[model samples]
Target: MVGALIIALGILSAGWLLLKALSRGQTADFTAIRLALARYLALALEFQLGADILSTAISPTWEQLGKLGAIAIIRTALNYFLSREMRDERGQTSAEKPVVERAD
Candidate 1:
């Protein structure tokens, strides 16, 4: 239940950030928004994974273990992709910065 709550919080946080960003009239700043949302989601997934581990420790049934394994794998994959995208976005943002031209 706590894990579920954590996931919900993550989603809510992401939504809040999106709305806040949009409200600021800076639609072009999606990179920052995405990065922030992804970070929250990743942290929430970690908490969920930890919760799953704790649940399994208390009741090590085969079915429970299977479910935990599947969930962990899916969450991990999501986190990996999100992290990769965040890295790419950061690189692109940095590259898009305007270089100052000094007058001689």
Candidate 2:
């Protein structure tokens, strides 16, 4: 159900990244590509985390609860790093943008 959807989204994201890379060739902006992929990964992880929570809510089994907790922690860690990297990339991108001087 939700798990299958999550897997499908992940696969789609990977395929998109591959296609983007191939289309761009050597002129690819790796930072932008990384940011885009990271965004997709983060979104997919959030959906996965939500699904885990829902599963535990419906079952309340100790095994399910344990699995949910572990999965939540892992997803949180991945999202934290992905967000940090995105922030760094955005900062670098902004800094690299050309500044134009206004002539009065």
Candidate 3:
């Protein structure tokens, strides 16, 4: 309960900071905040999934764990890739980032 609350608060605060920075035309700062928020969101997912693994009445424990690990890895990578795309959209990257947003 407490962990979830903390994660929620962190997400909100980071998102607020990102929006505020973007509104100020600080693209660099906004990108930084956006990355930070992504990290926090990943952590929250990891924590929640971990708790679910332990507490939830799920079947096939080992298989579930393996799938969870894969999911976490994929999700984290997706977030990073999306961040790169966003930065590219903002003209931060040297190469042109993909215009379409698709999960890897």
User: Which ranges in model 3 have alpha carbons more than 4 Å from their true place?
Assistant: 19-24, 27-29, 57-104
**Tens-digit lDDT string for candidate 3 (1-104):** 64477568778888788778778888754555655665566566666666655653456577776876776677667657766665664566434446777899
Stronger candidate by TM-score (1 vs 2): 1
In model 3, what lDDT does residue 99 have? 75
Q: Which stretches of candidate 2 lie over 4 Å from their true place?
A: 1-28
Per-residue error (Å), model 2, residue 73: 0.5
Off by over 4 Å in 1: 1-24, 101-104
- Of candidate 1, the 10-residue stretch with the lowest lDDT total is 1-10
Candidate 2 residues 1-74, lDDT tens each?
Answer: 65457556766776687787788684546676677667777887888788779878986988888888888999
Task: Score every model by TM-score.
Answer: 0.77, 0.76, 0.44
lDDT per residue for candidate 1 within 12-102, as digits (tens), equals 8778888887888778777776777677777777888888899899969999999999998998998899889989999999999999999
Best by lDDT: 1
Worst 10 residues of 2 by lDDT: 26-35
Error of 1 at 64 (Å): 1.1
lDDT comparison, 1 vs 2, better candidate: 1
